[model samples]
Target: MQGITGYELSSRKAEYLKYIHMQGDVVKTTEIAANFSVAPSTATKTLAEIAKAGYIEHTPYHGVRLTPTGTAYARFLVRRHRIVALVLSHYGLEPDEACKEAKKIEPCVSKSLTDRICASLGHPMMSVCGEIEHDCCCCCPSGDHET
Candidate 1:
């Protein structure tokens, strides 16, 4: 978690990580290609880069799974998105609109900023999109901190 921040990945790569995280299991390269509307070879190349960065383990003829570092990073990505979208909703955007807009804005937001925003929002446990997960590395109250 120390080295894996939400800022280091490109929007596309981060999206792929988020997608894989959401899937909750190994995902085929072809499935990724289909999800992003890219060629399988393109997915492979990009995934290679991701794997090189230590975010995933890719096996030939099999699929990819997030490393522990990747899992933590992806979770942060999801938390960042939900918190930002919740803020957008509070600022008058509809729930769906806020969610869509968050996807566009999330890549620009940092973990520190997200943590501050989450703290300001009283450590909300739910967002318009889903339940929020807190990490003690950031906004959790001292009493609520978890290992």
Candidate 2:
């Protein structure tokens, strides 16, 4: 968290992180490729990049797993996307529509901005997509994201 600025990742890389996080376990390169509709070789190359960035540990024959730092980052990414979608819904977009719009908008949103929006929304507990996890370093006074 110390070194991450929330902007260091490209949208594609961030998407991969989110997917890996959602999996909650080791993910095969072929699985990723299939999900993203890319070639296995393409996923392998991208996974190599992600691994070099310290987000995932990829075993040649096994699969990829997020590192601790990667997990934290992915959590933040999820929080950002949910918060953005929630804000869009407030302005008349439906839940699903807002979620779609958020995918386009969230990558450009910074962590500081996300925290500001979260605070402005009174730190809502649940979002259209899922529960909102608040971190002490941002909007929440309590460090526990679960709360």
Candidate 3:
């Protein structure tokens, strides 16, 4: 059976997209490799596949940027993952465990399921991993938004 294109994103690709979205502008392959602790060639290969899927634009020797479709999808995934993490936290799991579980489950969940999870969890502003945050908390609690 053929998988639907939009929903066919791998966790690694989704994670890379999330990182780029958070960072904004184009992101270098070397930086992404460093962040994920992978070799640059591996990162390049992964990015090439994503670009072929029309989710990103890869410039040789420069970096990668998300296409409009990629931006929207990445944002949705990030939202789902964070909400799931928060809901898991309420279930007595430690934050780190919740984040791990969220990462594992996020890609398989439908948007409707994510919406329900977010609603049930009271719409959390911070992810259990603490890497993602809602607009209201764009910066660290004690840090300036511009810093």
> TM-score, each model?
0.92, 0.92, 0.76
Q: How much lDDT does candidate 2 score? A: 0.87
- lDDT tens string, model 1, 2-37? 654468889999999999999888999999999999
Q: Any idea how many clashes model 3 has?
A: 0
The C-alpha local distance difference test score for the whole of candidate 3 amounts to: 0.75
Per-residue alpha-carbon lDDT of candidate 3 for residues 52-143, written as tens digits (9 for 90 to 100): 98879999799999998777777776777777787788889998999888888877877666655555554555666664433322223453
> What tens-digit string does per-residue lDDT give for candidate 2 at 1-147?
555567978999999999999988999988999999999999999999999999999998788999998898998999899999999999999999999999998989988888888878888878888888775245677653433
For lDDT, candidate 1 versus 3, the one ahead is: 1
Question: In candidate 1, residue 127 scores what lDDT?
Answer: 91
Lowest-sum lDDT 10-residue window in model 2 = 136-145
| Per-prediction tally of clashes | 0, 0, 0
lDDT score, candidate 1, position 95: 95
Root-mean-square deviation (CA) per prediction: 2.5, 2.1, 7.4
**Model 3: residue 22 alpha-carbon error in angstroms:** 1.6
